[model samples]
Target: MQVIATAGHVDHGKSTLVRALTGMEPDRWAEERRRGMTIDLGFAWTTLGAETVAFVDVPGHERFVTNMLAGIGPVPAAMIVVAADEGWMPQSAEHLAALDALGVRHGLLVVTRADLEDPSAATELAQAEIEQTSLGRIEAVAVSAVTGRGLPELRGALARLVAGLPPGQPGPVRLWVDRSFTIKGSGTVVTGTLAAGALRTGDELDLTGVAKPVRVRGLQSLGRSVGEVHAPARVAVNLRGVDKDTITRGAALLTPGRFLLSDLVDVRVHGDPVAGLPATLTLHLGSAAVPVRVRPLGADTARLRLGRALPLRIGDRALLRDPGRHHVAGGVTVLDVVPPGLTRRGAAAARALVLEQLDGVPDVAGELRRRKLIRGSELARTGVDTATFPAPVAGEWLADPAHWAVLQDRLRDEVERHAKENPLEPGAPVEALRHRLGLPDRALVEALVRAPLVTRGGRVSAGGPAVPGDLIRAVETAFEGLGPFAAPEANRLAELGLGPRQLGAAVRAGLVVQLAAGVVLRAGAPEQAVRRLAGLPQPFTLSEARQALDTSRRVAVPLLGLLDSTGVTQRGDDDRRTVVRG
Candidate 1:
């Protein structure tokens, strides 16, 4: 929603359309201006009605597809500018395919050069070609930036296209520096669309892929200094501590912990160029391009050895192509970068692995909902926007309907299992249950426990009579054997070797009561202790009771309180007195 990249074959009026819309030409490079063609990405933006849209004008020359891709890679939407006079071209096909394959959802096809020809003819041809792919009824309009023809329609079409986009959510601010340089008074200024979250002046941010942090001393949007900016806004960020010579395109200015850097990655390669790639190629992720050595696992399977380290993660889509050819050999979902080489082989197994990790929701909104209860780290690993990952609260992934059902049933079973094994325990410890589940996402376990389950004290054992039969028997036996005495403290029960965990479970089961000072008592022990105290002959001190019970004072005070509270004994000035007769 932040930026839209324009792509098509060169001479397609992409730059001209941008110029017409924004009244500022995107071809800012002097060489580009001299050549009358865009060889690199150009930047511009304009406002339409209530919305502001930014443009990343990419070169359409086949020789510059890499540059074009770099320009468009961060944009969620795009303007597939097809020159109306020439209709669809080769690079247009590649650009459209790349956008589709890379998963750019919100977009409209702009058939520019309306004044030069029957514009609808170009629109019709472009529409027919796009129908063959998954673009799903591309909304296209014909316009000529030179004649100011159809400009109004182009703006309105873009507004409608952007209307349905998911609103941006606040996250770690990241600006992939597509352009960086120095201006006379500004020091080092790097510009890129706000790819993720908010950036404010004087904010301390790290220049990742580098060793030090850069502070934002100033910010400019559309050439005007601004105090703060949010995602999708194109801005030039002025940095402190970073020199123009020290930084370049591909360096990302971001909040710490928002992303990671790596080199090696596992990926599923689609459309491999050759039977096997040569041992080397270039890896393009975000705006950073680095050389890598390719090791083919199979016709489409491979491991890439990057020439240098780069920040990457699982589920991040990166295009691997021949650096020399500058043609996309294939694209892959990064399973791991700086990851241990996959020890397994076979395309079937690897493909299955990739499919399994896909959140499997049909759309962004669905994915967001499905991942709602997912942990932030896990969502990052999946490379899905955390905001889109559905969950009731922030920082949690929403469970897929099917997965949620399975989780609920599993939790119920696990809680019951805990209750059964340690009937004396009050409930399962939430943390303990999470460990037991061993879910890849730990947050899901926490969410499951937080809702629909009662948490008392710190334990997460079963909330009710979910205790197992065998555990119940073990607890009952322990209780009967310890009659008239306090039930063994948790550690004492643990000494019997059922384990501290199982004993804690028994405590949660309500078969036993845990006293404040680590004492464990059978549920009925208080009544029995009271009955025993009522039969004691005389008022006694702690020592007398200790001797009579043949136990330490640790056992006497609680026992006396247990009895006295149950009408079994009464407290006197210095000793305990019994209340007789039922």
Candidate 2:
């Protein structure tokens, strides 16, 4: 299905044309029918060729221009109606300006009431006006809803227009609600044009501004209930948790955790000069109309602080209107959703220089270059495809190549400084280095480790101070005279100058193993003890093992505990331990 919105002057037969095409009344209210004017948005649908085309009929009067914008905001295509007798009018120009500001390029020009006068003049005039806007040189059709003249041609043109539209993209859902109401026996029902992504029954959707998520109790398209519906169609979703009053127009149903609700954004203006725009204006995007404060950054770039948070992304298009003047001031293409603060002197000008280079297209490389470091999920939320970018520094944490190189250099410097500051404990704790570099995750520090640097036991080391040659040889000689498990006592260690610092260096260099605070054993002593114990009768008591290795209770106890912790031995409930022979 494809949705098309109607736009024109107040009495230009926009609703009449839709009614004639769909064989249904486009105006729903009895007062509107009685008054022969559309005061609000109306909906109708018809099958054109093999495709179902939904029409969002909007009011053309100046007072309800806001309602017109709401109806046309979410639809992809449009039919700009102009009465043949009236040619072009003020409201026609205003509606055209709105569409142009929105950057809506796909549409058809319909010269309505053709039976009343020669439609050629009106057709030529409307075409000439449209040629100057984004909807350049669209297909034009002259039709009379009264006599049904040229109705078939209009339908064929609409069919071709819908066929030529770009295919709906699959991604996180952002359905802006245009209408919300309660149904008898059913909860709240919100209807809108599903521009992208699919919706399924029972799907949990996040209602913007609502604390809790709402469940999709049911789904309907073109007045028929369905289990699921995809994009480019008009859908009415039955919600379970939210009330009708809570989920009003402008409220959006979003894919939870898939969007970034931003109150401030930097944008590139299309229609009007940024310097001339008012300080405050109404911003229309999707089905939302929000008041915003504009801060001009450049001739065509500015920052907009919205009245409320909206799920915005890069490349999204919207319009700004001067509510006092009752006219669209300009259109905006979102350049940056999570923009940097412009608090410093000349910061706004500098940011404008950067924003001028952005074309409002989501480019992974360009975004990474600008942001330096960002989460993959954040990139996705801002409409960037992380899969197309380079590999991340750590899990989902991307860094620009140049920035990553700088971080690596800084990490090396920090490690070297840490080693010099604390020679006895040369290795820096991973958490300490992470905090020093202001890195968000410890894994990033691990990823930064390179040659001459190693991570072990939660510390990053730059190959700590080497054990002294004399101390190494002396410790080896002292161990050679003792049994495998006969760890040196504190007095013996002191005699060999094997203090805590020396023992720490030796342990890091694999010269000796320190089992406990005061117990030191030769390297490979635990393995040797395990082998000796495996030959014991299945399970041996601690005393038996101590005697077997000819070591005291202190050395034997820590050795057995180390073996057990390393899965080389297991302790039984009987106070006996067995070596794990594998």
Q: Pick the candidate with the highest TM-score.
A: 2
**How far off is residue 237 in model 1, in Å?**
0.8
Off by over 4 Å in 2: 464-582
All candidates: CA RMSD (Å): 10.1, 4.7
Per-residue accuracy of model 1 over 1-582 as CA lDDT, tens digit each: 357788788888888888888888899889999999999999888887778778899999988887887887777788888887788888888787667656666778888877888878888888887776546677888777778878888889888877866677576776778888888987999988776688899898888756877789899997789999888778889888888887877878877665666666556676664346777777777777788877654445566777776656555666776657655666676654433445656754564454445432224444444343445554454345655544443244445666666766788788778866755566666677777776655455656664557666655644444566667776666655564564565565555554556666666556766554556666765665555554556676676666656655676777677666666667798675655533
Please list all clashing residue pairs in model 2, or write none if there are none: none
Clashes of each: 44, 0
Stretches of model 1 off by over 4 angstroms after superposition: 270-279, 296-302, 323-326, 343-582
Per-residue C-alpha lDDT of model 2 across residues 338-365, encoded as one tens digit per residue? 9999899999889989998999999988
lDDT (0 to 1) per candidate: 0.71, 0.89
